[model samples]
Target: MNVLVIGASRGIGLELVRQYLDAGQRVIATARDADGLARLKDVGAQTIQLDVADPASVSGLSWLLDGEKLDLALYVAGVFSTGGAISPPTQQDFDVMMHTNVLGVMQALPQVAPWVEEAGGQFAFLSSDMGHIGDSRSSRGWLYKVSKAALNMAVVAAQPDYPRAQFLLLHPGWVQTDMGTSAAALTVQDSVSALRQTLAKHKSSKTIHGCDDVPYLQWDGRPFAGW
Candidate 1:
């Protein structure tokens, strides 16, 4: 299968690339810097230099993957910030977080979704339960929460346009990554394993629910309701 992993430098993204490669799938991965590219290369993935937060960089994506039909596409790039309503985020923090977490995905959607659609594939975005509006209790890292919520909306909004691709918003749980920190609940391995399992079980049977049925799921396949 052909898979595309966007923002595959480290953490969940990197682990995804590693697992897929070990499974003997053809994988194309993107990283923003030399170190990241080197790491992906070391793990045997086709590497592309892409900074999703930059429009100019994202604009070249379709060209990069031309003629390729992707069986799966994972948008796993994001930024995290710590702040609450009381500790208002600075303009810089807001811009960086929103640009990376929300705007980057928006820019990448049009570029990557077509390839996934061509293959009747799955397009999954890495989101967080912290983004769940109805389920949210704490305001800590509220800005980050707002960014992920916007990301969820972006994926849902784009789903209808890519009818053959299953658009999924996945919460990888409290993963033990740099973003999640060491104290988080799940290790990167366990989180990504369940996520891969979830993807394997999903197929582009749009007829079952049509394009409007974008699924918001956890790493474990449990559906998350109430946006």
Candidate 2:
């Protein structure tokens, strides 16, 4: 299988690339840093340097992979702001997060969606538990939270547009990623394993139930035992 992983330079994105490649998949890992892409190249995965915040880059991604076939496309590129959601919110940080987390996904969809649809593949995106507004317990990282929440809805909205493809709005949990900090519950390996399980159990099937639970997460999606 061929996979395209965005934001493969660091954190959970990086680990996902590693795990996929180890599973003998042909991986094309893209990041904003040239050096980061180069490192993944040494690991038997092809690399592309892309800035999802740039429309030109998103358009160019299609051309880079035109000659190849893709089986999985995972979008995990995001930016984090220091402002704890409410106080001292910086305009620059908000713009950055919105571009990377929100608009970027919107722009990327038009390009990657057709390719996956033509190939009969899977589409997975990284959402967060924080994105769950219905289950909001508190608020600190407001910008990040809102952007990811928007992204989740974006994926949900796109499902109908690409009926043959499985669109995953996955929550990797509080993983110990660079953005996640060391105090997180699960390691990249553990969180990704759950994500993988969820992906497999829900892959390429359409019942409006392409959701996950870590086989153990509490209060995942809405409703119970029905699609």
Candidate 3:
């Protein structure tokens, strides 16, 4: 299958590229920098330069992949801010997180959605459980939480526009990555293994449910009740 992995510079994104290639899939990996692109190329992935926050870059990506059809278009780009209090976040923090986590998806969805739809494939975003409004009980990573929440809604909002493609919001289960930290609950391998299995199951099923029914899912492909 042909797959596209956005924000594949490091961490979970990079690992996904590696594992997909190992599975003998044709993988296209995108990153914002030359170094990241080079690293992805070393792993046998076709690399593209894309900055989700930049409209020009996003538009260019559409032109670049115009004729190519993707079986899976996975967006793994996101940012996390440290401070988490009742107080509002600083303008810079808010902008960075929103731009990377929210607007980034907004900008890329339009371009990638058609590709996935044309191929009768799936579009998955790497979302977090922290974004679950019904599950919130503490105040931590407030900025990141807000951004991811917005991302979840954005995915739902876009679903109707691309009925042929299945849109999914996935939580990677706090894997050991830069964002998840060394003390995270699961390793990158564990998370990616489950993720691949989930993707395979979804592909085999060929059924797309309503947004409310399957909005958010765990890494293992089970529906997340809290969402």
Candidate 4:
């Protein structure tokens, strides 16, 4: 399969690239710092340079992949910032998060979405339980939760418009990575394993579930409010 992974330089993204490459799939991995992703190149993954926050960069990638057929496009690029009841997000932090998590979706549609549409491939936005209003556990990381929540809704809204393609919003759980931290419940490998298993079960049906998390303490972003 022709697989494209954005943000493949570190953590879960890096692991995803490794797994796909080991599966003998043609994998194209992207990172803002191409040098950082050199390990992917060493592992036989074709590395592409990408900055999800930049429209120009997204457009450049779109042009590069326009002629190619892509079977899977996974948006794994994300950012996190600390926020608490007393300390809300700065305008810059909010903009950066939304730019990558939300605007990146908008940017990617013109590029990879068409390939998925034509090939009937699968598309997924890495989502978080922080967006789940159904859960009552609150989180203090406003930037991460809100961006993920917006991404989930974006996936829900866009799934239908693409023909033959299945759009999924997945919660990878609290993984032990720079973002998830050592206190997180799952290792990056374990989390990716579960996430891959969940993704492998996709059908044309319209529904969503990837072990939901309780609503936690989020800052002012209202990451838990899904409506």
The lDDT values for all models are: 0.90, 0.75, 0.88, 0.73
User: Cα RMSD to native, each candidate?
Assistant: 1.4, 3.8, 1.5, 5.6
Tens-place lDDT digits, model 4, residues 1-227? 88888888888888888888878889998988857568778878888888989998888876788677777888888887767556777888889989998898778865787787666677777767766656636567767777777777666666556646767666777788998899988888887766666666553433333223211222111333443
lDDT of 3 by residue, 1-227 (tens): 99999999998899999999999999999999999999999999999999988777887778888988989999999888767786878898888889889999999999898899888988999999999898987779888888888999899888877878888899999889988899999999999999989977866324454567444888998887755
Q: Estimate the TM-score for candidate 1.
A: 0.97
Leading candidate by lDDT? 1
Look at candidate 4 and tell me the lDDT of residue 68: 70
> Which candidate order results from sorting by TM-score in descending order?
1, 3, 2, 4
Residue 118 displacement in candidate 3 (angstroms): 1.2
The candidate 1 region of ten consecutive residues with least summed lDDT is 203-212
Candidate 2 clash pair list: 84-140, 85-140, 85-142
Give the Å error, residue 29, model 1: 0.3
* Candidate 2 lDDT score at position 99: 90
TM per model?
0.97, 0.87, 0.95, 0.85
Comparing candidate 1 with candidate 2, which one achieves the higher TM-score?
Answer: 1
Error of 4 at 224 (Å): 12
lDDT, model 2, position 104: 92
